[model samples]
Target chain A: MDPDTAIGGGRDRFPSTEHSLLEAAAGGLAPEALERVAALYWKPVYRFIRLKFHKDNEDAKDLTQGFFSSALERDFFARFDPSKASFRTYLRMAVERFAWNAHAAGKCRKRGGDVAFEPVGEDAALTESPEEAFDREWRRQLFRLALRDLRKLCESAGREVEWRVLEAYDLAEDARPSYAAVGEQLGIPETSVTNYLARARRTLRKLVQDRMRGVTSGERELREEMRRVWK
Target chain B: MEVNSDPADLSDSVVDHLRQVAGLPDLSGTRYELEGEIGRGGMGVVYQARDRQLERRVALKVVEAALAGEAALIARLEHPAIVPIYEAGTLPDGRAFYAMKRVTGVRLDRYAGAGRPVAERLRVIRRVGEALAFAHSRGAIHRDLKPQNVMVGEFGEVYVMDWGVEAVGGTPGFRAPEARLDQRSDIYALGALLQFVLPAPAPAALSAIARKAMSAEAGCRYGDVEEMLADIGRFEDGLAVTAWREPPMHRVARFWSRNALLLWLLTAYAAVKLGIFFWPYR
Candidate 1:
């Protein structure tokens, strides 16, 4: 099956430029839209291809890049029906469909270009359900994205203390330090430490929710995805 | 198009901690203080919290499955059998949260399993149906009704819960096949709830009522929850139910069973009068 097989024919009917691919053929691919979609989904897509399709790391990376690149070229995201399933479920189903097509095609050739991620050669076994693992990887990436944004926001706004406190309190890998101790190290009172921690966490939560909102349009879908991400 | 954030120290523990912080409801501006998590559902976590101003413990639900819709819907619905929302507002993260009367009770499914009499379980369903009736009167359909969404208190208070306003969603078995929800759709779920409550080898009359209400065609089912409750009322009163057409012998048996004591007294008096009337000495 070719890339267009995932979406049925009669592509000439869409009324707006919002459904790309046809628009991509006219102007060019929407690079920002394509990049945002790929940025959030590529890790899970790669991991899912490796486990569910039994593809090697290199092949899974190729399919991951191929699927997203093709997704833009064929107006895949616009065809999603939120009523039938959540976007997460829809994405999973689409990845499986793409993988099956690749398997049937004997080999899924590299579509866009070389993948930017290096495949970890040693760790390839499944430790959990592939769907759950995919969800976890997606969530991990979401948090990573939010964290990255939090750092940039803190730096730009000259609120580095808030980021440092959040990093020290919530993001600590070892046993977290007491509020008083963290205050002593950061040269602030314990009360200010408490206030800063609350402020930073509040910001982080909003940032994470904003990231969630970026994916789905509906309020209900956003809330459901919020619960799912936390779970 | 590029992958980053690999070496930034988001290990499993860090992820768990970050998720915990994200899930925590920020109650800085509210009158409630979080104690701990009570439980979670499809929507969000319910926390056991204290209302410092009211000096009462309330169940605080931090909404995640909907924006403000669930809380607002719940706040509008006020019935003794329906759980009442006391106060609602947005959390710091912009998710809605509401404080409600902290109900101490068993879910209807577990309560039904505890060797209770069939009459007692039927009564629980009646209260649930009444709550739905009140909601319907206010132009709201529960859309999702099941045994799990109902709670039976120690003093027999019934609280119908988890009233979220949404579209095209429900638990599978309890949900009616009809896509568009109306009063009848809730009737369908109540029927399923009744079926869940019934013990195996249930009374045939009650079983027939459940089956009729659960008919695949929505029109074939009870017109509304109140109408269904009336059928249950008929069964409880030893009268024929609208759902089931009792056969000739069963009707006779039921009549006899209902009037057995009076019939025996009348028959004995008539035998004595006849003996005195036909006595040879007279």
Candidate 2:
């Protein structure tokens, strides 16, 4: 828990929120918005199935896809009442309810009949509760989304210097380079390394907050989520 | 530069590092070691950082380089109430920052909320007024003066924090309708700040001063912070203020309140003299 990880991204909207996702579901379940939700949430859903339902990797993967397809067809997300609970909590409960009913009925949906998404890797250290696992995976997938967006941001906006600074300083695969060394490597002033890194980090923070906003129902929920996860 | 749609497989440590980097203002190249955040505002976040070379704790206002003019602004005017900037530089993360003496105390809003006597609150607000006056004298307008921006220390010292030198727009409630930042806008903020610090049953004279300072029209407000402070001075001294036309009864009451000790002594003396004069026809 880094002390610096205090919740602070004010007003940065990248994509949308869970409210819009529900609205999209109501409006014939817009495929694009649903796909974004699936991409962002598939890992969390799969992890929840694996940890909570005691499913093997293949079963969890199949159930994960089935859950999304089933929820999509059944209009599960549209029933979210923001006042009752957070979208995250609502989602977790929905998954649990769906899994229990399916397991009791001795039913298995045909595989490969749903939205395709990246599978959650072997997180064998499931010493924590299922809820905690789902939340952790949610945060991890959030970072991945932000990282993916950052890559696109740098490319589209020609922010290569900022990206390079972030890579050399923070995302260094090996030993992190010194500012002077990075400056020499990039053929820019030593000071510019930090300047660019600052820009990149600011952008990254906004993206992360934007992702947080996308999952939350409103500004208040987004702030609560930021505090819950970051702190 | 070669662009990839995805980041190279991010490890757990990478995510951890990203979390720190996203929230923390990296100060690797600078002497200040960030302890924790003090607070944040529109301009930037203020962190309680230790100046390694000086071996003392200072507040580092870590803001974007574009919004880092506060250092130079404070540097120009050396006033006791204005938080003094010690050094200014760019953090390793490239955000421009300025290190200043970290005055430990409650914000004016919190301090006011503590239910201090109106006179005590008035004294602190007067100091805040003086600070704004000094800045205005130096041809600089605070453009953002509110209870939250003023710091009241334990030793009864007040420092106006968060100059917001680079910020064009002030906070909503305090800011005047005037779009431009000027001395009058600062006066408007000062009035709002004055109103915030005052207790609910604020005295008529003092409330009048705040009301004049916070007048909707720019010209209707104080010509300068000095004028507002002068009216505040008059209110404190039990003299007639320019802002309010005090009725004779309220004026007499104010006079009595301000000179209670002297008036009490005079009344006692007059009673003794009258007792001696009327003493059995002596």
Candidate 3:
């Protein structure tokens, strides 16, 4: 068997875990999968926030914990169906939403009074010299993670139609084939392919929102996360 | 080919080896032939190596996978201002490794001492500014736009290396003093470079502009890189008084010599007239 075909290689796994978690969540084992993936992913997500925002330890930790707690309560993992998007992408979108809330809250607090939070240490080890390209790449990576999860989730759910339309139009590196060609391949009209892609995008957006439910608490938080993740 | 569900194949061995190598315990891999150390920074050490398959010289920079992540950030980037990242993947030990074209050039700080004349130095400075502007347009802010980060090749090609501390809109290095590290950060650095490269007076004016751009109060500074570039133009044209003013050291020497020459000429004329009067008395 081609081992490379698996999700993440041995010792470092995600794809299988995500699948099992999703299935478990769907089949009443969701509680267990939810806890496991959350436990595994929380710190990584927190670290991302810490590094990207250079937030203090407390704030980073709080956001990290809050994101997972919200996810559990909101059924983020339980709602996973490859029919919508990939889990990795789902997590990133969740984190982005979390960041926006934290940022907006921080701004609001600053307006009211002195926000007393220590800065991340000056000695924080930097891998690259500070350059704008570095930051853009970081943002792009987050985008890619969400996109990857979306692609994988759809493929897994046997939603080959929606998945293929998105894959050909949005994800694939090459220029998209004409709608007619795509239609011929998918056994749908060229117009249908375009229409399908549009619908698929909306589905992807909803999937992201669904995932956010597990990561955020209320309607306000959900809306904020949705905006952040979608953006 | 049959698909394997085993996780082993999903992760690359190269990724693991690199992770271990970067983490400091040591590296023992035959797949990657580490030739020699090229450079070292906060992130990782760069090695010049041979790609056994392609048989081409490539620079390998090993970083911590956990810190670096699944996709190599450098690999996805392309810019004239940035060193091109060619490929990235994880080693066996989960170390993240990135490869790029080997650049042969002197750091910007060393460029000035390379015996290049003033015009060449200014050109290098301008080129660096242009590169910074390009990256800024992509919403990338180079917080550390110092001389050392800029490199100049033998052919006068300039490249900006190290985007490690970039602030997107506002990243860590974008201190309140610089306010927004965007293109203005590069502009400040360019202004500093102009001070060093351009003739004396030009530096002062350029420095003033730089100081304004880098002002802690963001409102008082040039809004963007375009504005900064326009200021550089003003300096180059000698319109910037602080930058183009004659050095005080030259002023004193020139003033003394001119005054002495004038006095000597006037004395000579007076002596000739007196001599004419004396000749009449005789």
Candidate 4:
């Protein structure tokens, strides 16, 4: 089916020169339209979540559904801007922020902190049979596959200077060590830790953006994705 | 040293290096007789070739002009369902090359469409599903899941052909309606495959299920591969040989979209109000 007539048709199209789609999305297109637009980009968001969260498919699906629901919330839409960055950048930034918030809250919950969990959104109205649904989940594992490939690529290039730091801390936030501690672990001075992290962060960010290239468009969008990771 | 990365660059220098390495012949006695190209796509080109050392035929796939970085990623994988990469090095032309056990079979499409018996076709589809399920369980997602890429050997071995197109399951048209294409998207595509292979007597209920499974919207599909697999098991166990077109709930969701809105609004109001009152005190 052509995506145009569905809610996505009205939401946004690619190579978004200006942020007209962002504007429409901000203004509240119909729920169907939101779904249409979300459909176009959900894969990237979900992949990022899978890589960041270390959660399996069931959890990934819940988080992903939650992400879209969060995006549609009144406050989220109200705060969005087109001129600031591309949609891909905006979406990735949103995911990073959301994950940080969610992780922080989960930690709070573990501490006997009574943080209320909002019922963000309803379940997706999926129609495929059990067999078909199985196929989709299998396909979803591509992110891990891609990550594995990326790890090997880096190793072969002998670009080990900072990738170790990235691999260690990027997957799980809790395991992150202070710069002094990292320097001790790697047997480098504390000052060199900062340099390692800076270089590592840049390389990690570049690796992700390069893989993501061609799947989207334009140099600006790629830069936007780079900006998004730290967001 | 850090990989020299210019932000605008997609050129995979790592792959380029590997291609250079391949030129040196890591396999002391093996000379690869490059033959005519059998297939080509965005990632690499597959050529029918002779592995002189093995004294047998094999396929050598040289990395495309792009995707030079994939040299490292593809080289590590070892699975029955995947096309195995035996060695990774560079070709004389400064392109990365990998050799795998060349496959001989018909594309799934040939055996999947009309004129085939329903039972046999469904069996083939099930094998495809199992192979994909196996891969996912091992933490791999074949983002490019389509009939053309699926190879069905003479003995019915189903090999899912590509991973070069893979990323974190976000690219559309590859996985289920949910984000980060999971096992469920493979199931949905398999469902689509069933539609391609089976006759008209197949149920509309199945199609609705397939449509939802393959939904462009990630949030509208099944949660994972296992759930879908369970449903398929129930389906096959019952094997509604008669092929019923419409199930009752399918009718309800269609006619009820108008009412679906009303119900959603009533629920949303309650949720938001309650959410506001119970909002986290931060």
**Model 4 misplaced stretches (Cα beyond 4 Å):** A1-231, B1-30, B64-79, B92-94, B165-188, B239-282
Q: Write the per-residue lDDT of candidate 3 for residues A24-69, one digit (tens) a residue.
A: 5666765556564553355446556666666667776777677766
lDDT of each: 0.76, 0.74, 0.55, 0.52
Residues B1-282, model 3: lDDT tens digits:
122221112122222221222223122342456677776543455788777768888877765444374224444446665678767766544556777777888887777774677667767766776766776676555555666667887777888765543232222332334544555555555555555555544445556765665565556666666677777766555444332355776556545554777888899999998999889667
Between candidates 2 and 4, which one is better according to lDDT? Answer: 2
Docking class of 4: incorrect
Off by over 4 Å in 1: A1-30, A104-127, B1-7, B42-44, B64-66, B275-282
The TM-score of predicted model 2 comes to 0.56
- What does the i-RMS of model 1 come to? 6.9
- By TM-score rank, best first, the candidates go 1, 2, 4, 3
Over the stretch B208-267, how does candidate 2's per-residue lDDT look in tens digits?
A: 988998888888988987788888888777789999998998878888888899999999
Tell me how far the alpha carbon of residue B248 in candidate 1 is from the true structure, in angstroms, after superposition.
Answer: 1.3
Q: How many clashes in candidate 2?
A: 0
Error of 4 at B136 (Å): 1.8
Q: Considering summed lDDT, which 10 consecutive residues are worst modelled in model 3 chain B?
A: B1-10
Number of the top DockQ candidate: 1
lDDT of 4 by residue, B206-279 (tens): 55556655656655656665555555554555432122355667556545653677888989999999999999
* Residue B158, model 4: Cα distance from true site in angstroms: 1.4
Residue range with the least summed lDDT across 10 consecutive positions in model 4 chain B: B1-10
TM-score of 1: 0.86
Give candidates' CA RMSD values in order.
7.1, 11.3, 17.2, 27.4
Rank candidates by DockQ, best first. Answer: 1, 2, 3, 4
